[model samples]
Target: MDFPVLWCVLAFVAINMIGIYDVVHLKDLLPPLSMINAIAAAYLLDKYKLPNGLVALGIGVIFFPSMTAPIANLKILLGSAEPPIIYGKAPYVNPPEGDRKALGRWIKEHTSITDMVLVHSFGTQVQVYSERLSPTIYFNITQTPIAKARFYHDLRQNKPAMILIPMFPEYQNLVDADLRSFVSDLVKSNYHLESIMYNYQVFRINK
Candidate 1:
């Protein structure tokens, strides 16, 4: 097998191990994850024609975790009356929750921090909505993907002034807190917090 294909297979086995491990250890959490994985597997299976069965299985394993990571994320659609907060691959902007205009204004006002922008999953929003700001972008949700190496890059070099989260929900405060904590861990804390609304909260990073 080619190196890329072999690496994909290994990734699949590792992910399947994670799911199996989750099933064995955290049985309660496995069902939702399993359901999400099943959906992704069945969908992707139909879309991609993999000649090798083992390769297909590997792809399934690798893809399942991202599909099922959020247990209650699906509720926004089935339980809601209005439009969902996520559609297709793009995240749904909850009305009054995450105003693109507000984000743009924030970015426009902080033009000097253009190089410091790092939106986690919705990092694209900054580039999409903030027309006034020409950002160097140390990390973006769509364009830039990384692990821990981006830490010093964002803090030391880029000096990101804020984080733009797009799929920010209305009810899941605890999950939101955890997500914020994860984002905050990446930056230098310039201020305590600039603002916190219902859908999104803006943090004023320490320069």
Candidate 2:
């Protein structure tokens, strides 16, 4: 009963279970799983006295399929691919439907520096690009009831010049249904759609 092997198996099972439950991103598990693979490989090599080249080849065979997308992406980045390859129902370098950078530039040009904006994306990409303040620090306000309340309060108090709502499928899961309904109603009542970036809807406060 090899303790190290048993421990590695337990760790692998636990990490996969956590990932299965949607507690963490699958990408986050890569590091630990890679470490486990290294340990297992070391053990196998010592036990079987396997040639180094054979072990390397075996590892490459096991992981090459997973590397295909990344390899394609590398080629795209290097300007070697002309049109880019489609893999797993998506293009290798598929940019999101909208140009976020262009949207940010539009915000920066049209809105006053003093104006605050409300964005519902995951990061500060909009803020950084727009050079405008966001009413609330929490980007994904639908994550908690308190955050939602704070966002509502901020929305009323700040009267932001624009509210950017993501329209992409990937963002659909991040938004709460109730919050979405509230925002839709609010936008209908108090805001007008100013611009439609393919991935986002920009609404301006009605004058």
Candidate 3:
């Protein structure tokens, strides 16, 4: 076997081992197994004997997204900067803009230090800017069966004061039916729509 392909195979096994450990221990995968997998795939593609054109195409596919920041920076230097498009494979030209800081400030003013908030999408930003406790930190409900159950359990146990659902331009929030049903049921039973911010909805738990 080609050395890089062999390396990729070894890396794949190592990553799976770590992943299994994380699942068994109810722990988050450190450094993200996806990143490790991506690196391994890149190495394999780089070393695998293939048509010159195909190799070039594969490398370009990997290289382009990583260049977004540099390209944006160059645009800034030339005084032609567009609204800072975020970096990723399916790049959006200019996403719908909203003042999250203002929303955070509002949350801070309305909620107490002890109040736990649940935020989807921009959980870290809300946590940092709002300075409130959030049970949803680094936890994604759709990732695994354990995570999904854990999310519901935490919601039941903590009864967080607020839940924020931001409207994405791509409407990713609407994709998961299971999660949507859970949120809808929770809203119907224990929460009410408190306010709608520029690009998000805040729901308050009934006291």
Candidate 4:
């Protein structure tokens, strides 16, 4: 009867309906319920003496996540799972957002054309608006060491006038250890906390 394909199609249809209902009504995915549905689908197939196809389909629904969940649970028990890195291109900032808009305005008010600003990451917004030079716009996985070295070199050579710490909620507490350490050192050495407005920290270099 090709019941597997039929069951799969039915499952997909059910999933789509739930998704549409969530968007139009709940506005939340209700992920736990989704997981419950997947498990229940498999259990019902087995209990009903349905073809092995449906049971297999049900198992397949949650299989990959079932495998990974144990590892995720272990990591949570031990500590947090490693923070994920976000990537971006230079001179192409995301459209000025809530805090980002405030930051852009502040940079324009204070920084000058020839000034150099050190941004933790996501430099494009300030760089474009301030017309100030930045060491790098975004962190890269492949060139972590190179990025670190270049930042050190920039500190020693260019000696940026100000360092901007824009507080992106996702990355506020999730920066790489090396990058965090570097920023801590800079703050201790020459940078002074000028202001913290709208989730942005402005650090001006000591004269």
Q: Please report the candidate that would top TM-score against the real structure.
A: 2
**Which of candidates 1 and 4 is the stronger one according to TM-score?**
4
Compared with the true structure, the alpha-carbon lDDT of candidate 3 equals: 0.63
Off by over 4 Å in 1: 1-98, 110-115, 132-138, 142-148, 165-182, 186-188
Candidate order, lDDT descending: 2, 3, 4, 1
Candidate 1, residue 185: the lDDT equals 67
Tens-place lDDT digits, model 3, residues 18-96: 3333353332333344456666766876788547678668768876767777987799799997664343224322123
Tens digit per residue, CA lDDT, model 2, 28-75: 556656776788889989999999998899878877777777987798
Alpha-carbon TM-score of each model against the true structure: 0.38, 0.63, 0.56, 0.47
- In model 2, pairs of residues that clash are none
Local distance difference test scores for all models:
0.49, 0.67, 0.63, 0.59
Give lDDT tens digits, candidate 4, residues 1-207.
Answer: 354445555655665553323232342334444555767776877788788776677667856455576887799689886553332332222333434565666776787777777666545555565656665433211125665676666666666788766555534444566776777787779889888644556788898
For candidate 1, write residues 1-207 as lDDT tens digits.
Answer: 654455555655655543323233454444555656666667776789645587677877876765552544566556744463333233434544255566666666765643445545434454555553322343432221342345434445554556554444532432335444655565334544566422455565665
The per-candidate count of clashes, in order, stands at 4, 0, 0, 0
| Candidate 3 least-lDDT 10 residues | 88-97
Greater-lDDT candidate between 2 and 4 = 2
lDDT: which is higher, 1 or 2? 2
TM-score between candidate 2 and the true structure: 0.63
Q: What is candidate 4's local distance difference test score?
A: 0.59
* Model 2 Cα shift for residue 204 (angstroms): 0.9
Error of 3 at 183 (Å): 1.3
On lDDT, the leading prediction is 2
